[model samples]
Target: MSDAILTLDNVTKVFGRADKPVYAARAVSFALHPGRTLALVGESGSGKTTAARLIMREYTPDEGQLLFRGVPLGKGDARALRNYRSSVQMVFQDPFASLNPTHTIRYHLERPLKLHQKGLTSAQRQAAIVELLERVKLDPKLIMPKFPHELSGGQRQRISIARALAVNPQVIVADEPTSMLDVSVRQGILNLLNDMKAELKLALLYITHDIATARYVADDIMVMYAGQIVEWGAVNKVLDDPQHPYTRLLLSAVPDPDRRFDDVRFADELGRVEEIRTLSARPQPETAQAGENHFYRPFPAV
Candidate 1:
């Protein structure tokens, strides 16, 4: 990732006592460049969310550095840290939980401008809120005064994106933005993310367990397992030509229009998942360049 807007340098995070430990992240590393998205995919308890937490500054890395615009974060100058907070906003996993039930959407968007762009007056801030709503394809006049429960799931998500843009962020961390929405609406949310990335030149971290959705929004993909990135590369290259057993296992779960999640198939693969996990959890000797753009760790001999 050349000219990255955000970079995690050998970042590590742990949860538990010093005597015993649950290693949530182990030397995890990656970068997010402007106008591109990096999708982090893995099953439950696979450290996908932990990585997001680290980038969001909800959890500081116990072991490594987080760099924003080539400057190392944590203990930076007051002005620099302020910029980081304002410029790196997150769209959480649940739109319903993230928004304020008591406040109107206009209040949510206006407060950020008040706190971050103090130069803007009340009239200018109000105008900017409407523009943001318009940018996300919402009717500002109709939706601005509505509370969270009043809008549809997709509309709430668009409001979340609009609020994220309120601070004029250069990087967006969207964790499973569409996972909870109806399938019919998922594509619309994905397309909105794609358009935001291209038009605003915003770097994005699109985190999810679903590789199929990852393909729709990201340019690059990283497959995580047991706190390590087992495979990564260009999204299509890695998905179409997966080199890791774990990656293949995940890809196998996607629903095809003709084939549902259960259609009398994958019985054998489902039965052998424990074996795949066993092999995948073993320490890899090194990364192997398995394709022109794909890379993964080979399973150790049984």
Candidate 2:
């Protein structure tokens, strides 16, 4: 997208020995545009978290560059770095762990304001905190004084969201935001994220292994395997017609109401599909367009 707030241009990060390096992220590329959510879906150890880390600046790319508002991120000065930090925030997978048990919810929210929004008076900061809680659909009066231990998983996650918003960030990297919550409250968190993306025009990167939830929350979808984005495009087009074997394997794992538990065909298909998994560990740079907005790297002939 031309107006993307953040862009990962052919980014790559590796670890292990030079003779046998592990490509955590191999020539990975994607952009986060405002008012949109790009869901990064994959199994554990699939480099989804690696991509998030790259964006968070927790791990700098061994190759390629990250551009924030069209300027190279690594080349930024101290003030620019501070602006980048405030502009891109993260809502982590574990809400309780991301928060401090000793601190009140108010403390969690107030620190960001005190740091990034330095001009705000005590009263204004309090008002901003209240507004943030309300934005995440929490009751500021009730939640402000509670510690992290007192709140449920869902509530803590909301507080996390509120904290990210405190800095007025443009990009939000939500790594498995709802995975730890109960199934009943999972939809509520997804809904809140959707609402926030629309209302605040935030660019959101939602990382998860749940294909079903990705379909629910993302405008665009990218399927990662051994660090490669095998397929990506508009959520509906890619999910409905998954062109890559890895992408199809992911969608196949989601619960299917029409398929019977004892069906021999279903089991056989899964076994056959799994063969593609090992092949994906190698780099596949070739690509083919499946639809106007859909694309995938072709699997080597089985």
Candidate 3:
């Protein structure tokens, strides 16, 4: 009953046929409050993207419903869905792939304004585009005329962000926005995102495998393993005092170092992480709150 902008109530996503199906997301539940960020952290194939997809309305959940400001979204109304799309935007993982190579950056930003802000004239649309570019700290005159490939990776990412903001979105789902950029430029992008969130008060869903980056922007963190959220709470509390085995296994992997991305070092702990993942994925039998904010889904037999 919180004043959350977006909430997923026991969301689940299954793939393949009934006989042999994979539950990409299992009863995943979380809320994105206005002016705050939620960091969905896990290794690859841990259902981080699946959660993002569910929020973005790209994939419908088979079990639960998605609520926007406490009202469930239905397919019957075009106007509501259109408004939802305009308010909810996304910045993809690969900036280059997200943009069109043939089109200039200005074209990309202007199209959204034309579609969403019909009240604005051509002159006003152009001005808005320039302002959007400047908001991401990109020089409008120089960067707007250039194509996607002409700019650097970081610049392309800035353009991607600029486009997402063109329609004046209230929520942004950035799926690993910095994972593709060079290490040197990653900090700049992270800072830019932090600034935008503060200025616009947008609810952001930052999906990534890098826990260190998540610590920088997220107010809350949800640790996912084997397509389920095993631990979730305030960012520092859960990350600093992680109780679940899979959460600890994810933290032990040196995120900034040259360590293997998938190499959960605790892999040798008598299958502790995987065993916990399978056990945790099942529905929690009852509520067991650890503290004011900390919560963990207990294993079936543990």
The prediction achieving the highest lDDT against the true structure is 2
> TM-scores of the models, in the given order?
0.94, 0.96, 0.92
Worst 10 residues of 1 by lDDT: 259-268
Q: Report the lDDT tens digits of candidate 1 across residue range 1-302.
A: 46988899988898999987777887888999999999999988989999988988878899999998898887667776677889898998799999999999999999889989999988999899989999999999999889999999999999999999999999999998998899898888999999999999999999997778898888999999988899999999998888887887787776668766666556566677999998887666477998776888887888
How many clashes does the backbone of model 3 have? Answer: 0
lDDT tens digits by residue: candidate 3, 1-302: 23799889988899989997788998888898878999999888888898888887889899988999899987646777678989899999998799999999889998999889989999999899989988999899999789999999999999989999999898999999999999899999999999999999999999999899999999999988767788888999998888876777677754446666456554564357557556666656454566768788765565
Better of 2 and 3 by lDDT: 2
lDDT of 2 at 153: 98
Residue-level lDDT tens digits of model 2 in 18-137: 999999999999999999999999999999999999998889899999998898886557787688889999999998799999999999999999999999999999999999999989
Clashes of each: 0, 0, 0
RMSD of 3: 2.9
lDDT head-to-head 1 vs 2, winner: 2
Error of 2 at 207 (Å): 0.4
- TM match of model 2 to true structure: 0.96
All models: lDDT?
Answer: 0.88, 0.91, 0.85
